[model samples]
Structure formats: C-alpha cells, structure tokens
Target chain A: MYAWFFRELLPGPLWVRIILTVVLLAAVVYGLMEFVFPWLSEYSPLGDVTLEDG
Target chain B: MTPPLPRHADPAQRSVAAATRRQRRRRPLGAKIMGGFGEILITLGVLGLLFVVWELWWTGIEAESDRQDSLDEFYANMPARPAVSDGDDGDNDDDGPNPADFEVCYTLDDGTEIGCADHMRAQTGSEQIMGTVYAPRLGENWAAPIRYGVSATQIDRGGVGHYPNTQWPDEPGNFALAGHRNTNASMLGNQDSLQIGDPIYVVSYDGIYVYEVRERQVVLPNQTEVLNPVPSDSAAEAEFGVLTFTTCHPMFSNRERLIHHAEIVDFVPIGAEAPADLVHHEPITQMFYAGGAG
Candidate 1:
C-alpha cells in the first residue's frame, strides 16, 4: 500500500516527487544505522546472535 | 518446366521449415529481455577485460619514459665534485670552461645586432615567438617554437619574453629564459616528463649552445635574482655561464613555476660541428652526461 501510494499519489507534483525521493532514501539509511532489526533480534532467543558479530 | 532447387537445399528444407514455424511463434518481451541481458553481461565482461589490458599498456609507456629520464639523470651525475666543489677553488669566471662564452656577430631581420633592443622587445603571442628552437644536443636543427597554447600547435614555441637581463646569444653568464607555462605546445610544459640532468640546446644566428642540467627548483615568482650573472650562493662560487629556464608547474595552474637550470657546456660556433638535423646530434651526447654538483 505504501509503495502504491508513493508511486500514484504522493508524487502529485514534480517538487513533491523530488522531496519524497530524498526523504525515502534518508529514512532507509537512518533505519539501517539505528540498528532497528539488530535491537529486536537481540531480545529474541531464536535470533542468531552470531550474525551481528559485534 | 521445373525450376530446380539445389541438392543441398532439399536435405535442409525440413530443418528450414521447422525453424520458420518456430520463429513465427513470437517470443514474449520478458523472455527476450532475459536472453539479451545474458548476452549483455557476457559482452560487458569481455570489454572490461580489454579495458584492463589497455590501461596496462598506457601505464607502461609512462613508466618506461620516466624510467629513461631517471636513468639519464643518474648517468648524468658526477663521480666526484669537480675540483670546483672545494668552494672558491675553480676560477668560476666567465672565462671558466663554458661552451657559451663567445662573440655572437650576426644581424637580425631588422638589420640590427643579433639581439638589438627592438628585436628583444618584440611582441608576444602566436605571431611573435614563432621562431626556431635549436638545441644541439637533443637535435641540432631548428624547430619552430610553437607559440600560444599547446593546443594551438604540437611543436612548442616558448614564450615571447627576453632573457630578461642577458644579451642576445647572451654573454658569458646565466641567461634566463621564461615562457608561459599554461600555454599550448610550450617547451616548458613538455618538460614535465624531463628527468634531472637532461641536456637542452638552443641555437640561433649567433651561435650554438649546449646547456647541461645543473638543478631543478621551485621558487617564488619574485626570486628573479637567481638570474644574476653569478648565481648568488652562500659562498662566492664560480661566475656562471648559466641558462635558467622557467615555466609554470603542473601544466595548467600557475601558482608556481618549475625551473630547470643548466650551465653552458660547449658553445659551438655557428659553422662548427652542429648537425643540420637535431636527430643526428643524439649519438654523440648519448653516452656523455653532465657532471654532478653538490
């Protein structure tokens, strides 16, 4: 739904499309840097701790 | 009347009919794209390998040429400081063993001394500095110095400025030669590839001169005193028969100019053994390199 909305609606104008592209890239990188997955994986016993490698 | 088909065509007819039907079944775009992508990857892989090979070849030329310069410079250095290294020992005068100290008696196009005031003050740019550069060691024949920028012409005709303080066919002393470093086809820019101790010869109607590389230095633009008749050193050294050539360094930008310094080794008279062509002058000086100074 988010991908479809971004492709069909959020890009209502050229300026908005440019802004959306920048924001989406920034968010993707930010999410990775915040270790969102690693933090959650740490609490789960089944998660492979060795994969994080400190 | 039977229009006959060749015997080979009869056997291939069945295969051609099968291929025709199969080809008539058009391929879907997605399948076609996948097949094309595979071919593209293969082509790109081969190209990348060839590119690597080309790069290696280019790198070899640069390295080999520079190595030749390095070896030339090494061979050019001295076994020991010629007796002159003892500080104020050698006469170090204009009369000192220089190939440059000679009377240059010749008339210019304007019917004046070889380097009359009007001749030295000639204008700069494409039309003016477009004269022949005759170096006896490298090549004895006169090559027209390419003026303006390197792009304007392949043969560099150096800058239009005078030797600043020297006479035409300059008297026995250090003579300064300046050229625009950023210009196209400049002798200075082409010299980026020059190793230390390379020999440079500049001949004219006056006489033929052989300049052996002495030192290379990067100095401020105002360091013009080096052009003094005698290079002002810490101690009173020998008077010079010097040829100081300057150009802006790094080829394009002129924040500083690289200087190549040499002393006149042998000033051959005009009708003397100067070869008619520069290419012929090589073998004689090939084994003879300049002596090193401290």
Candidate 2:
C-alpha cells in the first residue's frame, strides 16, 4: 500500500517526490498530534491524571 | 531481418511473450501478501511511537501555551495596587500595601468574613483561574495557576485545578487541587519532592495563603476522603483550612493518587507583603505591589 502510494499517487520526479513525501508525512503527523491523539487520549488510561469519588 | 519481423506480427513470438507474462503474473502471491502485512505492521508501530511522543511532549507544548494565556488573563483582571510616592517613604513605614486597607471580596453564606484566604465560591463548571500557587521547594521559579475545575478542560492547561467540591483556601475546610504528573506540562511533576513543613503559597485575588506541608501519602483514586472538609475524617469538623495536592502516582501511571496535605499557616491579603517564604515569581508577586499592574 505504501509502495503504491509513493510510486503512483505522488507526482513529479524523484527529488520532488521526496520533498512531497516529507511534507505529506509532516501534515499527517501534525494532524495526529494536534487532533487524533488528544481525542484518543481522552479514552486512554495513559494520561488519566484526575481522581474521582467512589 | 525485416525490422525484426515486427515482433508481435509473428504468432510464435507472440506465444512466447504471452507465456512469460503468464509466469510473471502467477508468481509471488505469498511474497506480496507477506510484504503487505509487514508494511501494515510497520505503519502501526510508527503510529504507536508517535502517540507516545504526542502524550509526553506535544501535549505539554499546548498546555504550556494555554497556561500562559490563563496567567495573562488572570493578571490583567487583577486589581491594581495602590500607588505610593517615593518622597513620601517616611509617612508610609510599611513595606507594602496593608491588607486591612482593601475591602473584603469574599464571605461565607452566613456573611462571615473569610479573611485573606479569598474564599470565593466559584460557580460550577466555570474554569476560571482561582489563584497562582508557588512552592519554593518545588523549584525557584515553579508556579502554576490554579483553576476552578479539575476536569481536563482545566487541568490539561498546564496548571493545577481545584476540585469543584473542595473548599477554597482558608475556608476552614480542605481546598483540594489536582495536576498532571507526567503529561500536560507536568504542573505537579515534582510533587513527591515536597518535604514535611515545606511552604506552599497560594496567591489569590484577595491575598496569599501560606500552607505548610503536613503529610504525604499514596491512596487509591477512590480514596477521596483526602478531599473531605477534614481530610480522611468526614465526621470531624474542620477547625482550620488545609490544602491538598492530588496527582497520579508512580510517575507514568495513574493506578493511584499521590496526596499531599498542607495546613494553612498564614494569610496575607492583597496589597500586603507576601509571606517572606513565598518564592518571588515577579509576574505573580508584582500584582501585589504598587506599579506592578499593567
């Protein structure tokens, strides 16, 4: 899937493709960090810092 | 010889080409499957690692920014200190503004004054900044704004949060606050470093309430008795106010809560000199002295 994405989905020459890949990767990581991860953290126990009454 | 017989024009040559193509199409099914599976696994691994980075690092960045905004808003809304002239130093012998000079901002339901503790009952769900907390023992510049709610909307902003049901500072009850231990700017990241008798200063709009650490314990999340009017003793009436700090225990885990209780030792109303022990974080202490307001 990734190979297909890199080889076919992206356009341009090798150098342009490489830069595009970096940019795309950065956008994905930024989205995950700013949106997906924070929302997922709500359900994850990893960042549960508050206590509750029994 | 004649243009290589136009390759495909010859039936024999066409058959040979077709056979190779068939072989190429028939081979590597298993390898393709395994390769795809490995790619998926690698993608999942990278995503998991990124999630950890988000939790440990990215969250702090966002929270710190939020905390800064909260601090700025709190200071901006703070009442300006009474002005003093340099040449009139002899007339004003006191070091700073006198607490007695400021009007009371909070009182109990029965109209009894709560003094410099600034025991204002915040409306539920209003995530307002209640005060700024400073602990010299925690760090020379360690300070976090305490907000009204303990939920993520408040605590995740890189500051301590007051449990809604808990009492306010110097209110003759337990004033409980919560903070993240390892994430969200780790406001109380060094909570365990507190020592017995260490001073924790809570600077509210009315004044600074000084609390001295009295005890520390690890308790299950449900052991909320620590937030009782009289911590761990619901039956007993609180004779004086106490401060409680609650955070997730064992550093990176939230299986339990690390609790610290501090007794309110003194109160210095706004305009008065903060307790000598209070760490002088300029942005915080400046709000109390003349010309400190912006």
lDDT of 1 by residue, B164-255 (tens): 34433344455566544433223344545545666666534333456677887776555665656665663444343576666665544554
Candidate 2 lDDT over A1-54, as tens digits, reads: 686687557886568999999999999999999889988997877567667865
Clashing pairs in 2: none
For model 2, how does the per-residue alpha-carbon lDDT over B1-294 read when each residue is reduced to its tens digit?
223346335667755654655556664879879989999999999999999898888889989999888777777877666454354467766445555665543454555444644334442345577778888898886778887888788888988888888877756899899999989899999999999999998877767777889999999998888889998799998877789999999888889999999987766677656565552555545655533232
Report the alpha-carbon TM-score of model 2 versus the true structure. 0.81
Best by TM-score: 2
After superposing candidate 1, which stretches have Cα over 4 Å from the reference?
A: A1-54, B1-131, B134-160, B167-170, B232-238, B275-294
User: Lowest summed-lDDT stretch of 10 residues in model 2 chain B?
Assistant: B116-125
How close is chain A of candidate 1 to the true chain A, as a TM-score? Answer: 0.45
Q: Which numbered prediction scores highest in lDDT against the true structure? A: 2
User: Highest DockQ: which candidate?
Assistant: 2
Model 2 CA deviation exceeding 4 Å by range: B1-27, B84-97, B101-119, B122-127, B277-279, B283-294
